[model samples]
Target chain A: MSEMTGWLLVWPILLPVLASALAVVAWGRERTQTLIGFAGLLAQFVAALALFVQVWAQGPLAMSMGGWAAPFGIALAADTLGAGLTLIATLVALAIAVYAWADSTPEQRSGGLFPLVLALMTGVAGAFLTSDIFNLYVWFEVTLISSFGLIVLGGRREQIDGAVKYAVLNLLATTLLLIAIGLLYGLTGTLNMADLAAKVAQLPPGAALESIALLFLVSLGMKAALFPLYFWLPAAYHTPLPAVSALFAALLTKVGVYALIRVFTTVFPEGFALTREAMAWAAAATMLLGALGALAEVDLRRLVSYTVVSGVGVMVAGLAIGSEAALLAAIFYIVHSIIISAALFMAAGLVVRSAGSADIEQLSGLYKGVPWLAVAFLLAGLSLAGVPPLAGFWPKVYLVQAGLDAGAHMLVVAVLLSGFLLLLTVGRSFALVFWREAESAATPASPAPGASAALAGGGRHLRYALGALVLLTLLLGLYAAPVVEVALRAASELRAPGPYFDAVLGTAELRP
Target chain B: MEPLIAIVVGALFAISVFLLLSGSLIRLVMGLFVLSNATHLLIFVAGRLTRENPPLIAEGMKVAEAGIANPLPQALILTAIVISFSLFAFVLVLTYRAHRSLHTVDTEAMRVAEPAPRAARLRGRDV
Candidate 1:
């Protein structure tokens, strides 16, 4: 790769870090901070798109942080997978920035929202681009702390309560991740992923290696909100401001799933049958339980959070299948989930604001009040439920096809069942929140006065952000072939990883 | 020395996990601090501790001489230390604020976010 192209690898991360510093300096001036956030995310988006285009055209790109060579220095690399995810992440961040511009209160903005969001983008981008194991851990912590700040931004009672559960569980997960990294480093004597891939392959298949893999699975599983470890997510996600919750719903857990795919496919490509099996079981259970959780929720935001969890389960099931087609489907699902989840949460936020309540029972007749938002909610929600002619459907189709081919019948059943459950949940929520009339005759069939006032002031920007995301999903669903092809190439890269090694280590044949 | 350190790390982990399971938020914060220290020690011990010269190369030498201590793990531990320390401080402050606002330190009482579901009173309502 050309040196210029390699610099593209740094821009996605660099732009955000720079912007965050600027935001910190511009603190207390909400307008300046918003402008800074826009400029930063826009530049990062451009860089991410350039990186994706370069990687797609040529191949994976890698660069050491300094002049040092691989296996010793930190390596930042972007294959189609990393570059693609970074592009989507930046796009999502920009959308949420716009949404927050309209939705967040001045108090929350002055609480350093702009800086925290930028820090979050930096961490998410770095996590995607880093090809070093230890660096990945560091980036994970970066994401963690920034998210902590965002979660407790206003410091309301519920926010603090939520932050407590969120903080304690996530800190433990990161610590466990550190312990796993230590064990892996001790075993392999290297932290660079390319180097570790070679060394780990040479190690005999035994308990020591398997246990390390298991540790990684457990830790990352918690981060991804996999079954039996997802309490923190639903417990805390709904407590934050709606816009803040949208950002978290969009980017946070996906990073966990991304890391899981990266580590398994790149660092330890084979000989973890037991671990893969455990993941498969977890995937099925997470899917079923997450959908059930969504089914059980009365609050709109909490219900949407459960859908994110269910979507993680779908993607993990693809990883468990461990085929080219399955990985492609998994990547496609992740891309779809990121956009759709953000759109759903933002739409839910509008509903809550318009009705002045999140409880479905207290919410009613929104279809007459704000027809556009109701449509947006249905569009995004249906896409999430894997309805036909939407972004969500294609992934499930491919996943089911791949699962059938692999004879993973149980996973196929789980995917289909979960999709059905999601459809029911969304439909039921819509019927309650938008279709039915208010039970209290004193209440009028109109948007709340506060909601209309806010809409008049800045809510159009909120609609624009949600509109762009929903439109993107629509276009993606319509024009899925190119994306599917890209996902196919990305999956192939993950399966082989020869180009990744060559890019990172400067030699492919160095490994025996 | 490595085995002994591993034992200590294991004990720290045990103690932290015990503390973490307590209902009190303060114990949870303390548990996290202990947990992070344990992880740092684990990383340190995993690097294979050595009693040797610092890993600086002598004048005109290309690489460090034999029997020099490995510097990589120390660097890694230092980064981990700073990160964990800052995060610990953040968690402590958050817990303190949570206590002040929620008026309780017991996790069981901190149910404002996810209070027990109201008893199905609106079940039959069409709206």
Candidate 2:
């Protein structure tokens, strides 16, 4: 790769950082900040697309900061997986930016939303691109702190309460992640991932490496919102503005999933039978528990949050299977989940706005009240339920196939079962909220008076933004061939780290 | 020296975990502070404690000599401390605000976000 192309890897992180600073400077001028946010995300999307195209065309790309060599200086690397995720993340952030313009109250906009969103994206892009383990930790913190500010933006009682749980739990998880990085550094005496891959491969398989692997699995698992660790997600996700919720649903947990995939694939490529087995169980439980939690929720946003949890389970199940095909399916599922979850959250936001209530029990007549929203929600929900000819189905099919090939029959059962549960959950929610007529005059969560009027003002822009996402989901489903092929190549690149090492370390001969 | 510090790290971790499990929010924040410091100490000790000169290269030398102390872990700890300290401060303020708003410090009592189902809360209680 040329030096100019290598610099493409840096733009994804730098653009967001620069935009965030600009947003801070333009704060209190809502219109100007909004423009900055939109332009920044657009630029980020272009950078991501350019990086993805470059990586797709000419293998993985990497660059060292400050002219330092790998294993010594910090290195930023992008394989197809990282680059593709960055592209999708930018696209979703752009979509959410539009939705935030429409749906966010003035209070939320003035609460430093634009700057915080840009900062969060900066951290996310950094997390996706960085190849140094310690740098990854820093990016995670950057992501965490910005998300902290976003979560508590409105300062509502619920937001504050939710932020408390979110802050404490995530703090613990990141600290554990730090401890794991420290231990890994101690063992290998190197922090760069490419260098660590070589060093770890040379170490004898033993309790120490496996233990560190387990620690990573647990820490990253918490971040990914797997089963028991998922309490913070559903509790906190619903408290934020709908746009913020959509952004969180789309990007945050996926970073944790990305890290897990990166660490397992490159740093510890081979044995760790014990950790993988534990991961298998965690994946199964996360799926089942998340679906069950969705079933129990009446609030639209919270229910969508649970489905996000279930989607994470599906991706991690692919990781736990430890096959190239499975990883491909996992990557495909990650893309599908990001777009679909964002669509669902925004759709739910619209529903709550139109009906003046988020409680499905009090919601009805939406089929006639807002037919377009009903259609949007139906399509997004069906896609999320893994219906055929939608983006979500292809991934589950491939995952089940990969599981059967790997003889992980239980995981296959879990994947299929979770899909069934999700279908039921979505089906019931739709029936109650859109199909069934209102039976009582009592309203449980009467929308703050005039919420519908406010929604009316921004309804067209909101629909346009959400419609674009739904359209993309439909197109991605219909044109699954090319994306699937890309995912396949990315998965194989992960399986064989030689190209990654070459790109990052500038060495032709280093192969573990 | 490493063994003794390892024991200290272990003890610190145990105490912090205890405080974290304590239901009060104040203790939770304190526990996080202790946990972070313990982690930094672990990183410091994990580099293999040694008394030696700073790892500075002499004139025309490409890299520091073998006897010089390793500086990476210290650097790592310093970064970790800064990040954790900021997060700790943020969490402290969040806990304080949560207490002021919800009028409670107990996690169990702070259920505004995900309140217990009315039926579940009302079961076996007189109206």
Interface RMSD of candidate number 1: 1.1
- In model 2, pairs of residues that clash are none
In angstroms, the error of model 1 at B121 is: 3.8
Q: Which lDDT tens digits does candidate 2 get at residues A384-468? A: 9899898998999999999999999999999999899999989888887877654445445433333345567889989998998
lDDT for every model? 0.90, 0.88
Task: Please identify model 1 stretches exceeding 4 Å from their true place.
Answer: A441-451, A507-512, B56-66
lDDT string, candidate 1, A1-512, tens digits: 45677788999999999999999999889889989988999999999999999999899888887767677888899999999999999998899999998888888898999899999999999999999999999999999999999999888888999999999999888888989998899888899999999999999989999999998999999999988799999999998888889999999999999999999998878738889899999999999899998988899999999999999999999999989999999999999999998999999888877877788766777777688898999999999999989999999999999999999999999999999999999999999888887555634534544456646678899999999999999999999999999899999999999998989988222221
Cα error of candidate 1 at position A444, Å: 8.8
Off by over 4 Å in 2: A443-454, A507-512, B57-66, B118-127
The 10-residue segment of model 1 chain A with minimum total lDDT is A442-451
RMSD of each: 2.5, 3.5
**Candidate with the greatest lDDT versus the true structure:** 1
Task: Indicate the DockQ of the complex predicted as candidate 2.
Answer: 0.55
